[model samples]
Target: MRRKVRNYILIVISMVTGTVSFAQTEIENPFGLVYRDAITENLPGKVNIQPVTYTLNGIEIAANVYTPANYDPDKKFPAIVVAHPNGGVKEQVAGLYAQLLAEQGYISITADAAYQGASGGTPRNVDIPHNRIEDIHGMADFIIQYEGVDSERIGLLGICGGGGYSLKAAQSDKRFRAVATLSMFNSGVVRRNGFRNSQVNTIQERLKKASDARAQEAAGGEVIYAADNAIPTEEAELAKIPYDLYREGYIYYGNTHKHPNSTFRYTMSSLLYLMTFDASTNMNLINQPLLMMAGSKADTYYMTDEAYRKVTNAKDKELFLIESATHIQTYYVPEYVSQAMEKLNVFFGKYINSEA
Candidate 1:
């Protein structure tokens, strides 16, 4: 009985550490996207990647631009700017979707926000709402001027937290001819109310803590943050943990899809701004075509649903759901991703090319 108990504990530990059968691939690229269908290296004579850097508010934002096979600077093409999740960098799912869209002949770009990823900024991982919104606008500013891009036909695709920011960006930056979001997560909502409103009663307390964090930063003190949970390596303990969102997120962002610059934590001081912002507040301002997608089984599906309903002014709109897929699964799971890409292709094609 003692031996059996010990073996069971070990199994739980492995699960907690994300050392299970699915996450066993050897890390290949510094980007650390090890999923089965991940495109780690650029394919010769096909999709080409250009590492780019541009200044945004005196900070250099790092980005990757993917051009399709047989790209010609002489031929105009519709462009798309992809926004990464809140805790994510441009090199993960955002990059993946941008590359796949390029495969279908659209020029796509994904960039690290000013204070995150390979981008330059102080007070690292500060995830304020306005900054993320500006990041999307900045991507539009850059990609609109790229060679062969049709500025009037530029589109936007935001994933997870990026999705929320993209919506806010589209509210005023009408340069985006069409806007789309995948697995939309309302960062402001989750940050303010807590995931699933679990911390609704503690809102004032958390706000006070955020206020103190800001004061500390003002005094040049150490940064304070949330979401620094240590990775668990025990299967029993891991299995006991609930919330598939956090569990699978750890497996992806922290393990299989880990990148050197992809830490998900954000400054606790950001809550001062995050808790009061609402990405969907001015949904009526988005007067262009819009597409919002979420996994039907995602715990965060309510966000997409709520936001989509408020987009009453979109010239055309859709809220697509990937059946049987959870929030994190849609990030890299081949079938779910393919479904999203297919829908995006048709949506962008119809709207972006309507004038041409």
Candidate 2:
């Protein structure tokens, strides 16, 4: 199974090198390098987003915490721990959301998933199904230990892959009072298939790649990875949108996005774990305060709806749709972000603030 996963990764690498081009097309991202309305425009708080490290599963994980200017250490405040997407680090959209959420007086921490970003881990981006789940718990643990954090008032906000983990965390651990995901990706399903299950047609072809990857690894060939957003020239209109997001993701996390040592991609082995993992497998088990938000126009809209229907035990659940906001726009747009923050503050306030 591992070998099969590795071979799928090789295909990603091959595409990057143009050895085997999937689509000989290059699409431009509408968000592009210059977004006119930046976060600085909306962030009026004394934002103190700083880097910190904490031990998790014996690994010293790296993270950044965004404390709103409204923060008052004299009063222990509620905190929201944010998780990045698969193949993403602390600085991507996750951090952006964290900072915005912080401006509302919630302490938010965005961390490097194990084996990615500046955190200490070997076999980078290996994509172990279990490790990602544990990373959520690790962040939870870090927040509670902080001197000024109101441990019982803690909530979680996960973006993409991080979103799946948040749901998993609330299901298994009773610690989080609430959980939310933005443009959540069922990392497992996406990897096993492709965008909208487009690559799920042939099992034989997949198996062959697995066998080939095992052989290639045995030969000590360097592992290759898929470059973000290399949609074929012939891809459908919807597919082109995600490709644009990938391109924008690279720019945000790769360059303009702050926090040093972060990256937009992970190791090739991450492909192996991703192929078999699915957070939706036990959706009915999560029973907590749940807020599932997505752009009305996102490719990932189905997963959010699917997850919302399955969590049989959730005490309170709400599905929010942002009008005109696509998956990528929600990541960087202040108008969309402010709307999300407003909803989130209301949700967290019902749970976290009401208690005080």
Top model number, lDDT: 1
Clashes of 2: 2
Instruction: Provide the lDDT at 174 for model 2.
Output: 77
Instruction: Give the poorly placed runs of model 1, Cα more than 4 Å off.
Output: 1-23, 30-44
TM for every model, in the order presented, reads 0.91, 0.78
lDDT of 1 by residue, 1-356 (tens): 01111111001114245444443435354334434444556666788778889999999999989898868989888899999987788778998999898988889999998889899998899889999999999999999889988898999999999999999999999999999999988988888898888879988998999999999999989999866747654445545657768777776776666677888688999999999988889899999999999998899998999999998888999989998888988988788999999999999999885556
The residue-level lDDT of candidate 2 at 347 comes to 91
> How much lDDT does candidate 1 score?
0.84
User: Model 2: per-residue lDDT, tens digit, 14-129?
Assistant: 32332322322221222111222213322345766667898887777988777778776777888998988776666557766777777678888878877777787865555666
Q: List the residue pairs that clash in candidate 1.
A: 12-234, 12-235, 12-236, 13-233, 13-234, 13-235, 16-232
TM-score for candidate 1, residues paired by index: 0.91
Give the count of colliding residue pairs in each prediction.
7, 2
